[model samples]
Target: MTCLICGTPYQSTPTWSKLFLNQLDSSTCTRCFEKFEVSESTIDFTDFLGTPYEGAVDSVFCLYTYNEPMKEFLHQYKFLQDVALAKVFAGNLQQAFQTREGIIVPIPMHPEKLELRTFAQVDELLNAAQVSYQQLLVKTKSETQGKKTKMERLETSNLFEAMSNIEATNYILFDDIYTTGATIHHAAKILKDAGAKRVDAITLIKG
Candidate 1:
């Protein structure tokens, strides 16, 4: 098979360990991937209600707009048990951040959610990207952001806390999806309050 991103034919051997197999065939050619670059698109950060705010995340960098194979990949990564897809998704993010040097932080999941899912997809992606990451933000309590409207989500956005021993540094917040900026905004706010010089966000898909 050929890699859509890199056009490389699949190697006979797999890159992942024996127990960690990929659902999608791995055939990305070296050349196709080499041409890809990570970049930040110009996006305005606003609360769910379209209320713009300063000091919300400075920028949001997405690898792809929510579409096609990427969308299916995300669906599998988030809902189904297709954890391997997280690695491919993270590869795009890694390419986007090739020139960046900072602590990569995942947006984080509540303990209950983490316990239910057994993993944070963003965390898995960061690990797959081979990037140095710190779990800087912690969700103190369970608040269902999925059910709320944009403004409602923004209004009750005091959900995260900066973990202890997280040194202030240039950091990027990572997540799987970007719908309204509410979650990223709150996560960035905590990092900024904790003294991160600049807080930028990177997501696999933008909605």
Candidate 2:
């Protein structure tokens, strides 16, 4: 089989396949898995205006920017309901966090919206990443922020809550898009309030 992340050729055990089987419908070759590897240079978390996070203590990582292959990739995963793509996305993330240890939290979605989608896209991607993480945040049932302006998004849109004590000093926040800084800002805020030393936010795209 091939490595799904880096596209490196190698043999994979059935047990390993079973671990990530739920992430993908079919097993990925060792090479493809290796090629999709997530690295520090690959991780990007810049805002539209090219601004980084405030008091950024640690590095923020993102698999793909909102462009080209990344744009197409995310579009397929988000709108096309391409479940397999979720595995690749998650695998990339898993590789990114292999060395770092901490809680990996996905941006929460409203329960009503979650019901409509029938799944949390961020959660699915993180699951594919194959890293240990927790669903610590829950979106308060609030208005959708898509139609809102940047300030409005920052002002409204309930995105996160502390599910447990923030024991992990190194925390990473994951999301599909980095349109505005609002969503992640809220998540980081919640994590910090829970006693996390640092909160790093990442997104697939920055636009």
Candidate 3:
């Protein structure tokens, strides 16, 4: 098999070992895996975007730093539509987050963007990690955040809305990357307003 990130060929291993490793490997070679800068601290949204709405997201857990390698990985996986590359982070996510009773809600994609991308990148990440989630939120706007300035992005709230009545008191929001903290805060505000008692978030990288 080939390494997903670097395209390096996997060294030959015993049949038994290969079978065992295949079940756990994320298609990332050891060298490439070592290159990733694992996050050693928790992220505070208030530090980036000031205080969030009352009773919004409590905290955010990020897995890695959004360095150049991670940026390239996301560009390939999301923009280039390399679907299979989702597996490269599946094992890492599963290890970072264990299943819990609360709902796992992936950050929603705008309908128009969804039509173009074919799938939500966060949803694909959760699927590859074998994590179950609910599609409770929907993007109300189609404007891409990449085009917006920092001030505009921060001011651009109300981008997401709950699709229906939410009964869950606890929720875990999932996303591929955290940039200005606007997206997660806005999404979590809607969840909290819909009766979520405590909302937390997890992201693959903090940009």
Candidate 4:
């Protein structure tokens, strides 16, 4: 098989060592795996919002930098619909951090976009990692973030809405990428307004 991120060929034979390492490496070749630079910093949500939002996201734990390899991987996994590539980050995500008793909420996709894409990328990542999550939020707007400019993305409003009353106090919002922080911030606001006490987020890449 080929490395998911770099496309370098490697042995796919099942063995004890390979199986043990696969749990940690997600089948990525050694060189490509080493290329993923782990983030030691966090993004503050308040920086993106012009005015302070009530119950804003506390912090975001991003895993990888939006480097060329990660960019190509995301484009293929998300845009090109290479669903199997979701496994590439599953191991990293599962080990990113521990959550204090709360539901893992994936940033919601609008029904129209879901119909076209046939899957939510974040949900697929959690699934590959065997992490349980709740689809508690929904995107009210059908707009795609990739086409929007920085200002437009930041100024966009009412993009997300809570589906129902959540009994959980803490929620971990998951997404594929964090570009301007608009998407996760808006989603966290909705969750907070719906009675979520604290909202934290995790993204595969910090662009």
- What's the TM-score of every candidate structure? 0.76, 0.69, 0.86, 0.85
How well is each residue in 9-32 modelled by candidate 1, as lDDT tens digits?
665445463225323322345554
Model 4 poorest ten-residue lDDT run: 46-55
Per-candidate Cα lDDT values, in order, are: 0.68, 0.63, 0.81, 0.78
The candidate maximizing lDDT is 3
Better of 1 and 4 by lDDT: 4
Q: Give the per-residue lDDT digits (tens) of candidate 4, residues 171-192.
A: 8889988878888888888888
Candidate 3's residue-wise lDDT over 1-207, tens digit each? 888888988753445534763434578777877787887776655544454453477888889998888888989999999998888888778755674447889998888888899877889898898888899999998887889886687666689989988985888999998877778888998999888888988999988
Q: Which portions of model 4 miss their true places by more than 4 Å? A: 6-25, 48-55, 97-100, 146-152
Global lDDT for candidate 4? 0.78
**TM-score result, candidate 2:** 0.69
User: Which one wins on TM-score?
Assistant: 3
Off by over 4 Å in 2: 1-58
Q: What's the lDDT of the predicted structure labeled candidate 1?
A: 0.68
Location of the lowest summed lDDT over 10 successive residues in candidate 2: 48-57
Angstrom error at residue 63, model 3: 0.3
Question: Where does model 3 exceed 4 Å of error?
Answer: 11-23, 47-54, 99-101, 149-151
lDDT of 2 by residue, 77-121 (tens): 677776666766554455566656667778888888777777788
